[model samples]
Target: MADHEEDDLRMALRMSLQHSPPEAKRSKPRENAGVPTVSASPEESPEVKRRELMAAAAEKRMLMSKSVAASKPEKSADVAVAENSVLIVKDENRVLGGTVSEKPEAVCKEEEMKDVNFGEELPAADANQLFSMIFGNGVSRDILAQWSNQGIRFSSDPETAMGLVQHEGGPCGVLATLQAFVLKYLLFFPDELGKFTPNMPSQNLGSRRLSESECVTSGDFASLTEDGKASALVRSMVEILFLCGSKKRAVIATFSVLCQGAEEQSEDGQKDEIFAKTLEGLPIESASDLQKVLRVNTCTSQMSAFQQLKEMLPVFQSRLGAMLFLISALLSRGLEFVQADRDDPSPPLVTAPFGHASQEIVNLLLCGKAVPNVFDGRMDLGGGMFLKGIPTSVEVGFLTLLEYHNLCKVGQHLKCPKWPIWVVGSESHYTVLFAFDTSVQDENELEQWESQIRKSFDGQDQSGGGGFISVEGLHQVLRETGINLPPEKLDHLCSTGFIVWSEFWQILLELDKSLGGMKDSTGLMGKKQFDLFHFNGIAKSVLNGSQAISGVESPLQRPRLSILRVSVPPRWTPEEFMADIVVPPGPGGNDPSGKDTVVEVTKPEPSQHAPLVDCIRTRWPRSICNWVGDPPSIV
Candidate 1:
């Protein structure tokens, strides 16, 4: 019976295919297939053509469903019921245009029940590849040769040395390692380090500026003699970097070096005697052993240990201060603090060179460990490990080589460093850069205003979107907005016969005086300054002007009100005020006073004075006496 049913199904399928429309039939492409296939007659409207195509598809599906149903053979009651259920699911899937051979729920469960190996280890990363990944090809080959001559070797397991590797940010481990070394270098030899200033001069302290003379360039490192102090410093840093691959190893190495130094100084009756006594029996072999001996599991314990180390700084007048500083930094953060979140199905090798730093790299230098983001550093990564963010003002931070080349965007913490000092990295060397003036670090207000203008352009753009519009469209928009540009200026702005937001902004920055000299004056004025200024101005105008009140005959005829107050309902928010406020049209839908006035609020476009208006509404509600219409005019 099954064989007879299969034969009948095959016959029905063959007949259906033979009678199928040409458009519905599947055919292999010919070599010269440029011939345009007619889907429908040209005279047929799109709606009729669409309906015919949908009907053809429905007809094909119906034929296949009927043939499939007819192909079923006689079976026992239970077996027939099960088969019918499967067929119904398949039919539903077919109608939805999905794969028909997808595994059923039972099949999927059986597959899941099979044995699986979750303990398989990934192949070890190559040492040479890891070195290339961190340093990139930009490093001179001579440097690599010099390192080899100095007995410096790449780690066999770079991943282990790098601690927890991030999937997206390539070679952050090396960058972090370099940063740690530079920080230590700054602490130990503040004056001897010619490339960077350890501390800015007192007069220029809060300015966060780096003078040209203070800036360290690649030439400083490149100019180093083979046996100079800087050369030796760089070599020692590279050696330590390779030695400490994992966070555990780094902690061990740091403590072991400190202990070894202390022991040596103890015999000489050096000032480090107190520190030596403090480290008498603490184990330096592993993080766990040291943690047990020091009892530094909690934040309070860590802080106490950090405080002790800091107290000992004055006693170490020599190079040991740098070591103590490094140790204190490590203890404050903890042993597992440097590990980054790993990616699922980790890559076998890191191929990208060190260029753009990940937020993790910044976090490592600013706080410790490559954290997952650049937020204010309040993230909890489980296991009692919380990551702190880089402070707004930092005495020291790292600047990547990519930022110098304009290949990457730097986070604000590093860009506007408190001291205007940075540990700048190059292809094969690291140096210090500092500034004496705040100009370099100051935010450009003109650029910000340009961005706002670009947004306005995008909102009004008709011919094209995305901050782009045709030359003619731009002219129309400018005119509608009450901006009259000279033909020469307009032509220059639209030199390509198209308005590009970036170019538009640049031209306007050069042309507009008000925006050119704007600075972030929020610090100069308190939070409520704008609102206060507005209220003061209004009060002064009312007191000093010649105009009289509505019922008064003359300006000075009646006693003036001593206090002026403006109040808005507590329920009204700034957003609600901006949306709900309306100004009645002047006399007859026109401003006979010839002053700037809004007839009707067509759209709420962003304005340069939006911050001022918002401040007034928020701080002293109902104080605003006037409203600016959408697309505020330049005049």
Candidate 2:
């Protein structure tokens, strides 16, 4: 059956080839030239046609045999096997040629060339998809669309468009682009942004030292030209993102070395192979030009660098320039040059999620060796340096910030940051919250009053003054200072009945302005009248969404109280109270004097027992006790 099918197939192929165009016939192999080709008429029967095809095929085989014999080579078995393989391939090609109408040789060569150059061309990618993938679920198409509506174009210019086309999309490219976008967004909406002085050295040549005047505010940034903005963006990425350094001197120094090397190569007319390879196609002319392009000093230099950075931005989009730029910047200065004074010794960041940014990244932005946790960042190392903490202000989510306030023991610095702005991060996105009025940050007068009040409480309290005072003690202090709370309101204010320093501070913060009229001799609100209403608005704004009370509540909620009362014999005198209940029995059980043998119990000083005493008085105000001299406080 197979042999019959093969014969039919061969006949069909021969018929088709015979009916082919004249060009195909001329293109056929030399072996077919001498064969007697028969033309079958349309009227011919199938049997006659088959017979003609079979005879023509036999003649073609005979001609092939004659050609092989005429050019037969004296070769080994291996060479013969190779020749046989080649002939088999050629026969297959020829058989396929009837329908294909072209030689396979040229096609095969073209396909091989395509495979070789496959990596040369950039992979196809949509700019939006690339960004979405790199930024993960944080940045979605909807968010990109929103940004687009706000005039943020992913592909703004021809260079950026082409760059996005060829962009090697990944976390690094996305991060760089995101940083650039953030800076641009700030520039676009300067009113929405707050001024902050990053803890980095000045980007100037004459004065490398950092000072308060070196602050780069939104106004300074907004005042820049388009070119200046671009230059600033690149400089920020290089110094903050790539190097992760707080020192601008390190970046400038590194670039200066590269410029010097390029200059030497230019002067000697014998380029260093390494230098030449590193800067192959870069159009750097002279050392001074390179300096102006890479470093920012005066306005002129910044504008010059802007032009160079604009061209380089595209290159950065299509390449992982973070590590490369880092290495180049640190070539002249060692890695230690960019190291933070105190940094996490863990391995560098391999991944950056929305809320869980790397410590280095946070440090670069916040200007401190910050811990990753959302804590107050305060540690008492037992010196005047107790005031030193991490970031004065931090960027955190709303819920995270709430937790920081309610659940965490937040420090003064974090509680009242220098700027009235926060970078709020959500589950899927990041946004900014800022105050239009900057006066909210100036709580110096209020803080000084708070400090004096805290000191006064500490002096009066006997618990070694660990920033806590009793509710009754605080009430007495407030009443003495001329601001009186109703008894029921006091209970509501302090649900625990024993107010800590924080609770006391909060109560003062929430006080009404009418009660803030009293004043002391010094004229400051600290010694007498605590005019906390001055910052009440500021406090409310800062703590807008951070309410301590959560969950369901009734219209008339009962105050929470924790109290323990120990019943004692009713008619006991003051000495009996101390002797019988307060003091434990002696090791010998009892003394033999028979007057219910008073046991001498060693006790902490009355001042040391003040906190316990205050707790007792606050909890059981109805209880009566007779005292000799100053009554012994509860301990």
Candidate 3:
């Protein structure tokens, strides 16, 4: 019964609880196993004040714990903290900031630790930092190390360092430093740049002194320092020269002696001989050739020699004049040898007269020497210059002097001539040497020989002239043959040796006999036949042969027209007949209706025969007619 009553009461309580509105449930405070609890009142309860003090003490302790924990080495937070109310707690002495706290000492040690880490020799670390700084990576380290092995150091100047960065096996800083060091080092020895300086005295200068005015002055130089540097360099060079021995010094001394001697003597044949001998093997055949050889062989030294010679020339004119002649002589002989040997070794065949000769002749043949070409600046014997196997007038002039003076020997050494005379012709000239044998048997043969030679050289004897043919014969040939050639040209052919006079006149005479004479009856009768013999009448011949009389001006009416008449030769072929035939008179003649009349058809003859004959006639027509018939005054 008691148990039932207990259940009913429990049920009643549950029913009451179920009817109440729901609210968040508060977590139950965990109970401590044996901790004490205190109660407190509002007013003067020591419990309230004590609780407040305890809470304050706990807050202070929490603050102190946080500070000490922060100072200790950090640990995982999950293992240190537990539930909302504290459960297990460490002993206060076991935590940080214990009663015998080492905080001040630890703080001092931390600061001191920094100093120890920084101030100590950490060589390995420092090396790493330096490597990284220079190389960026390890690429350049080996090269730098090699440089360091050689004891090179870095440069402070960035530009110089950068410049050395590009050389193979060269570290940037090291090479610049080395280069700067060398450059600074070189400042102590100033002789390296001496070679580039001007006005350095040649070694020969030790023996020769310059005038005061000619001496080079350092003040005149733009850079006095550079000049001093140059002088130091030159002095060093002089020392080297001195060490090289007196042979070089002797040569310089000799050159100086010669230069000084050149000033004094003014005329040194021996010196010139030495100069000429130097060029003995050279192909110098003239003064010009010698000059050229000198210019080439001496290189730039010749320029100095040239200046010196220029200074000397004016004062030694007489000596120079003789030397110039000697040079010319030497050159001429050399040139002759070269020229003569050009074709073959055989000597040119020479015909000459026999006579007693001089030593020069013997010298020429034995030595194969060419005579020196002498000149006096103007109108001199222009040397023995030969052209077309003959010597020119100027060459002969010199030859005559040697010959007249008996300076040249004949037969033994020099060639002699039979005669001193030169043949002159109307239009040509010839050199003749009469080499006669007095022992010849026939006088006629000798006379014939002389005649033949005279003819060979005679231009005047060539036949064809104005008086050789007759004008009457020319006019007749023109009438006989219609073919025409200009009279002036035909006359020239006869007179200028182009045609024989006899042949020219023969055909013209035949034509004159065949046609009787040319008719002036083509009468505009003002028109005259052109005379082919005259120079001005040439165009008239072509006109007469082809032109219409109606359009032509009358020549007979005008005296000028008469003079313009050209007596040209008629041109006809064998195919054309030469006979008399009737033709109607032209308009205005007696046959007003133009009736047929009998006229000679002589104009169509053999053109070849007539023109050549007319050519002879027109050239010497008077002489020809007089020869054929009763002599006429025309000749």
Candidate 4:
């Protein structure tokens, strides 16, 4: 009963507390765990201040711990952090100081040693020396090795100067032609050759000493560095005199020397006799007016010298002039400068004149050989140089002298008048020009009048004036051929407003070369025509509606275009024809014919009387008899 009364009293107290006013609840304290929590006075503030102070103290302790950790390197992480700090400071210092760390002195020494290689040996010859100056010794050595194989004899002895080049007996005309060819090579050498500089004396007298003031040019060409110009002219004369455009001419020029049986021909008559006999069969049966010195029998020799030359080759490497002539007659590789008269543009069949060629032909053979080409700063050979195959003992000396003279003019940029005055040989007297000019002058004019004309502005106007085309026009044309160019460089070709049609055509042809790299292949026009012929043949076979039918050749294959215009039916359509035709099975995949399973057709009958269409539709397989579907036609 007493417990019940206490429970009742506790219930009554809870009810009274629950019914208490809002002012009493405001001062209530919360419980911690199961115990009632104590409260601070209002003036002293709540426990939040104490908690904030505690947190401040804890933060201070944490900061102290971090400071201690940063001060020491007890762990891997601490050492890493220290290193990072050092690096950051270093970077900042570098940025602020504007300087870089220097490489070790030893490293610089090693690099210097590698680049210079001062311990290596220098080149022995000027040719080799020039190569060394440009490239390393390795390339120089290789070029030297090649030069030795070229079979040219270079002698320092004064007595051997005349005999430096071998003379093969044949038509003196042949030698003249060979000489002209040699001059051609000489004129082109500066543009054709590379860093293979030959040996030359430092004292270049003929051309290198020319001055711009004398030529009325603006710049001081004399002051320019000699490396580019000097390298081109160095020792070029001997090479030009000794070599021909092709080795065949060189061999013919040197053939007698090649056949020389050790003893001198002048001392022993036996070798001369053989050489004369050999010359009996050469293309040159008689001597030209210029060849009187050669004494090749003009009256009685009947054998074909051209025939003999065709037979001589790797078997014999001498008298290149004779061999070249013979090869020209036999293989018909016609001259690069001269065109063949045959319908086929390719090389022609051998036709030996046997001393029957015309004077005009002979003139064409050696036309400009007497004159060195005057290149108008442009690398192209403007005037034709008559390069004869044969060269006289004195001619070699003459060319050598001219070589120096021309070099000085070019190196000094000596204008038109100061150009080379070359000496060219002829039947009677040698034609030596003190000043070489190309402008058309009245033949009857006096030398003084010609000299005055050369200096006048008229000569300047004559330089390059005519119908001209610019590089941009060519670039536009190249775009049509599917070549995309940005730099659009015209190699070895300069822009001119007055280029001749022939020269303009050459430029177009040259620019077309860049189109070779285009995605679509550059097929020949003949190849395209052939493809059209084949396609027409296949269409005719399809139109015939037979599996084993013979194909009709396209009118393009005919020599006459009138056949295409008159023979092919105007109503013919390839697509409709292909639709009507049915192809039959072919031989097994193992067969060598092709991968397609096409049926074999009978050989087409070539009939002259029959219509070309019927002739083309001679045979067809039976499988095409059922393909009756109609298709659209492009005709």
Please list the Cα RMSD from the true structure of every candidate, rounded to 1 decimal place: 32.1, 29.3, 52.0, 44.8
Compute the lDDT of residue 587 as modeled in candidate 1. 66
Candidate 4 lDDT over residue span 385-486, tens digit each: 232222222112121122233331121121122222222222221212121111211121222322342233223333355334455544444444444333
Task: Supply the global lDDT for candidate 1.
Answer: 0.34
Clashes of each: 10, 0, 32, 56
In model 2, the Cα lDDT at residue 303 comes to 30
Model 3 regions lying over 4 Å from their true place: 1-257, 261-324, 332-635
Per-model TM against the reference: 0.30, 0.31, 0.14, 0.19
**TM-score winner between candidates 1 and 4:** 1
RMSD of 3: 52.0
Indicate which candidate wins on TM-score: 2
| Number of the predicted model whose lDDT against the real structure is largest | 1
Give me candidate 4's TM-score against the actual structure. Answer: 0.19
Clashing pairs in 1: 161-245, 209-435, 209-436, 209-437, 210-434, 210-435, 210-436, 211-435, 211-436, 377-389
CA lDDT of every candidate: 0.34, 0.33, 0.25, 0.25
Task: Score residue 342 of candidate 2 by CA lDDT.
Answer: 30
lDDT of candidate model 3 versus the reference: 0.25
lDDT of 4: 0.25
Identify the superior model by lDDT, candidate 1 or candidate 2.
1
For candidate 2, list the clashing residue pairs, or say none.
Answer: none
Model 2 vs truth, CA RMSD: 29.3
Cα-based lDDT at residue 396, candidate 2: 16
**Model 2, residue 462: C-alpha shift (Å):** 5.9
